[model samples]
Target: MMLTNAVLCLLIGYVGSHGRQEMFSVLVCIQTVVFVCCETVLYDAGLYRWQLFIITCVIAAYTFQRLHLSKKLPLRLSCFCMSLYLSKATIVLIEHFVFHPNKVPVYSYVTILFLVFMIIRIFVTEFDTNAHSFTGHLGLLCVSVIVNANPLIYVLSSYIFMTESAASDIAGLCSMVCGVLIIIAQSIHVPEDLRVRYTGVLGIFLGLVFIVFRPNLTPTLYSVFQWIEVFSVISFVIVMVTDSVTQFLQIMLCSAVLGLCPGFRAAIMLYPEDNIPVSGVLLFMLSSCIITCIILCFIKAQHLKHTFEKRFIKMSTMLAVVSMVAVISDISTRENHQMFLTLPSLKLILCANLVISICLKLLALRQIGELLPLTEPKDDKEVPYLPTIGNIATFISFVMICLMAPTSSFYHDVWCCGASLVLVCLQKDMRIFSSLREDNQTTATKITSLVILVTATLYRSDIWNYNSSWMFARGVTEIILVLFSIPNCYILWGLLYDNVLVLNEQIVIFTLPLNFPLILYSSSYTGWALAAAGIVSSIWMMFAKFALQPYHDDY
Candidate 1:
């Protein structure tokens, strides 16, 4: 039990480390689960454990210490602590009156009920953020239920029907294949007016094919649950088609009650023998889910109000996809064999990717600032030495290639070295390449060449070898390398020509092929879900690129 508590605490800390509003809400939900499990364990044992109490106090103290250092502690923490003490006192009083052997208390059941109400009041006052009106909260909860229903159906079906058959796997595969085709169709070049119609028709045809072949794809739940799921799906489709908030909320509310079913069923199954009443357990789980959903809605609202930069959004999307892949890979390999790369290696790769991306963005922004017509004139003696930055970047690339050579195939190393030499020669203004340099290639062309070169290296490295568990990690590492090179190329292009190359459709088009390797490697439902998300994102990007092309052309 101590080990379990410690692990849960660590997970809470890790997931909440980002400190984003969305993550904080997830942290609250996780902490609530941990608290419930602890209470359940204590109830079964019929004794309060001092060690657990001490652990809680220690964690609270550490949290407070950090809050003090940050000087951003909320007043709610103090209120929460006061409410905890009040609830404890109320519980003790109720126990004294109701559980005593000798006392003849008047209306003992009514007294207990009143005490419970008081406890609820204290909690609601202390914890409620009141960021949204009651109706707004209710509407967001309904939306969350609608969005989560599709995935929840699969979860319940897997447990209740135990339907881990080949058909289900085939359905997942079909969905992935269709998703990929949609992405490809969207990426194809065609007349602007016809392109939209072409992609739409292709998407509809593929979706129909998927539905026809996978007729039993949807899970057959009990009558009530099935109707609720169907209603939620229909309401969701309507919301998408019409983009009407009033209709969304009205229709979704009817199906929102279904969200409570999973938690209620789970609690009943888990605590059938417990002393707690079924209703109380159901209420606890429902409250936790509602709180989580509300937080997610708040995060979404905040995001919509304050839009992020396009590059940041793109980087975040890529990071999220990569993180999902890592998690899926970890789960799939857990029982099979040891992973090829250590946790530290994966962390290093992620950190390297993040740092390189940020650096590239900063360099591009700086270049833009310098190029602005309104910029102050610089002193001739103080002119920035751009060549030094290029040479330093080339050296770093050479070092990276050497570091990866131990794991890379001969061809991969040879290609990387050749690319490094080309970069070095470009930095040195080699006479042999003077004519090619004189042409002043566009940033898109430069980035495309680099992406293809790196991708070719990855292919030659046999990084997709799936014969062993460790091989999977190697493949992921190589993929990360390919992604890492994209930003590096952008930075390099900026340094070489003293001009920033705004990333465009070419980057997405070239990188889209990497998704196939991911699809090929994925062997689980979660992995397929991530792959589908990647494809959807690619399709969105394709449309967005086309939508914004005229603006770029005019500029």
Candidate 2:
């Protein structure tokens, strides 16, 4: 009964909320919370079979009516919803009579049926039918199914054979990279208006990598070198193919597989545990539903039919082969499970770098979208300073990274913060000063400030051994110094560059102030309040500088 409610909620939330993906996400989160709470309560009370049937019927009826009455909803969607509800209700009835069970099994045939319906709904409602032939659609469907099923197949095959070999890992990684590269290559062929939307592909890929891949320093370094070699060859070859619809089909197949693989893996992993953990199950459902919806939304939003060159497909194939062989050779000769758990700091650094890269890419995509004439301001002096969806997303990603860093850190808080500040200052100043003929007052000021910051960072051990009064004052001074210097450096950098900080950098600049309350007072509430203030102030600054008054003639 609980699973049925989850399915109904997922469908209604997805199909009923047109042009409101955020609302759908919220609905899913709320429904999952409510259902989990209710189920926990009901489990203790011992839900009866009759009670389950009654509940399923009521939920099913409500879902059917809700979907049916949505005026803008397609007729096919209505039918699909009805069929899904009826199927669930039928499964409950059969369980009542034959199995005499209180609830359907989580991994039962009914669940498989629900997944099939969900996938078909995604394909029918989200796929661009006018963009490709029937054969193309079928090919994509097959690829999605295979990709989704791959995890389960591997798990099952493990019982019969050794499925966890380096060879298999290499093959899987090669396949994943091939799919990603193909999608990126295909994005080049999409209409200009729709091209920016493909940037979300990077987000999807990074999100999956975060969830599924465990980083190791050695393999990562090796993979990078191999990827560069393969990328160069593929780029040369893909530039030579003729543009055609068939190539588009191949690209679509790769996109579908890449987009759906994460969700499918999450869902499949849900089946293995002997006891169902409510929190785990709820989280899995939420993430999977959200990913699927986001991907579908991207697909449905594109209207133009674009064809890719045939060389893209050939290049993708050759790249896959090359990557596979390279990975296999690298992995095969190495001792099993060696270096897997080594270099914990390296892994954290890699993950942090990946997050920053994705955020930056998202920012770039937002800039591209903003450049479109439709979104461009009519007045030369006016710029759009209001935060867009992309800006909000980038901010959220940045904040998450900031919050996550402290938890993952291996060094002292003070040293870590100081080092980060120094790095940011140096990185920005080096770039700004590189083209300058000689150091000016501004440059001299920054260099001196950096030296002071570095001296304070290195004096951490000495400060700790001082008398309590002196130690407290010194700590406060250091915190004040960092809080001051970090923003000053960024502001100076921004002024020197004659450009506003990008959303991600703005996040860094603003949130740097939180170190005061966070380190000196150790108050989370204070930290949060300062962070919120910083964000709001950053937005207001952007609005004031660009929207209210012209920052520059060209801008």
Candidate 3:
């Protein structure tokens, strides 16, 4: 497993250093050989932190040494270091939260590989290989360094305590302070006065330093503060880079937002009887505030307004409702891992607040998306592939967020798929309501919609148990969600057929119900009626698309 991670890290570094697609297959072969050799010779050895660190350092060296490594060596090295630190941080996080120390298994290896692969893929893809903007690279470097410094800060603090080395402690402190100043400097836009920026930065640095190094603080509290600091730094970085909020930046920023959600879940540890070190209420409040602010800033960003749609609002609302319901259900049934005593009214209020907040922000997003553009770029340059890639990544992140919601009811599955279908509708210019504008339709489109609607109606009785009634409801929800995808399927196909997109419609169409599991759970009849209405509306919409097809000819 260690060797596999090592090889994977190396492959990722190689790819990052050389941003060409042609040599990707060759790198794959190298990874395979490294994996096979390591398995053959080092299978009996235990993985060690020192070994991983050494391998990372070696890769960093090699990455810096490569051809066409056009970026400044220091800058590239810093990025690689941050990437490696993030990868290690990921493994440490998984070990602490997801897996037991003594239970290192094959599945753990697979998960580690997947995590490393994703982090690497994101870094390599989002990185401006051409180095188009100096400030952009600097911003990324600064953010990564600030995030990467947390672990080091902890390690150095521990070392200072253990070794009683005043010199070492002072050196480390100075370096971190310098790092913070650099971040602030990079974060400033052109003509932005450095005096004001540094003043703000100095204030931020003092607060963070105080929180981090405050005496008598518990380990758990310290960790929480560290995360808060990182979250703030990320927010600052995003704001700084708003001018260049390209697809890569958007996706990176969104992914960071999603990654921070679980940290907010730590609020569950606040119960007195839980024996958790921190105040759960404080944790939850801090997390909620941070998350709300972050979401608001992200959705309201001037650069990202064009990328969102009405369906995104619907998707966010549905996911939030499902999550809230799942949490409430778990608490009511005493199925929650956190044994905190929560009142039903309190739960309902929390649930409603979360849903309403998300919906309101999403509504703002939709409004922004609909607003007229100031001016399209006159340069004949095509839109980059990065935006589409970012959209897909954001959708994946949404799916993961939905799946993370703890729920025993089939509502979780139903809503997750429903949200994903909404994502399909939101892609590019395609919208849930955009079918109203399209005048052209084919006979095949009508037939396809008819088949889907009838098939869903007919399968309800056989697949879902009527005695339970929720099964029927689940069936209807599935039907409605699929039916919603019917017109979207045509929209996506039209885009593909028109050469607006290089990919086929099936990519988005097939994923409509991909997360929806085969089994159904019992629930209320409300889902059924809603889903039935949705199905009927979807059928009507499909017919409308066909009926209105000829109207455009006269205009």
| Candidate 1: segments with Cα more than 4 A from true spot | 1-173, 176-191, 194-394, 407-555
| TM-score, predicted candidate 2 vs. hidden true structure | 0.27
lDDT tens digits, residues 208-322, model 1?
Answer: 4433333343556554553443443444444334425322233324224434543444334433243335444444344323322322222222222222122223333443444
Q: Which parts of model 2 are misplaced by more than 4 Å?
A: 1-261, 267-283, 292-387, 406-555
How much lDDT does each candidate structure score?
Answer: 0.41, 0.40, 0.43
Tens digit of lDDT per residue, candidate 2, span 1-555?
577667757675565556464455345444544554465457446664446745755674466446445544344454455445444545555455545554545554444344445444433334443445433543443354344333332343343345552333434443443345335434443434333234334334432342234323256764553444333333322322322212334444433333333433443453334433444334343333333223222232222112111222233334334333433433443345544222222222233233333432333343453432223223765433322222333333333333445433223333333333222211112223334322322443333334443343434422456568766666666555446435644554564344455333444445545545434442223333333434454454555543444346765
Better of 1 and 2 by TM-score: 2
Model 3 stretches astray by more than 4 angstroms: 1-206, 209-253, 256-258, 261-265, 268-301, 332-555
Worst 10 residues of 2 by lDDT: 301-310
Q: Pick the candidate with the highest TM-score.
A: 2
Compute the lDDT for candidate 1.
Answer: 0.41
**What is the TM-score of candidate 3?**
0.25
Query: Which is the winner by lDDT between candidate 1 and candidate 3?
Result: 3
User: Backbone clashes in each candidate structure, one number apiece?
Assistant: 1, 0, 1
Per-residue lDDT, model 2, residue 221, is: 63
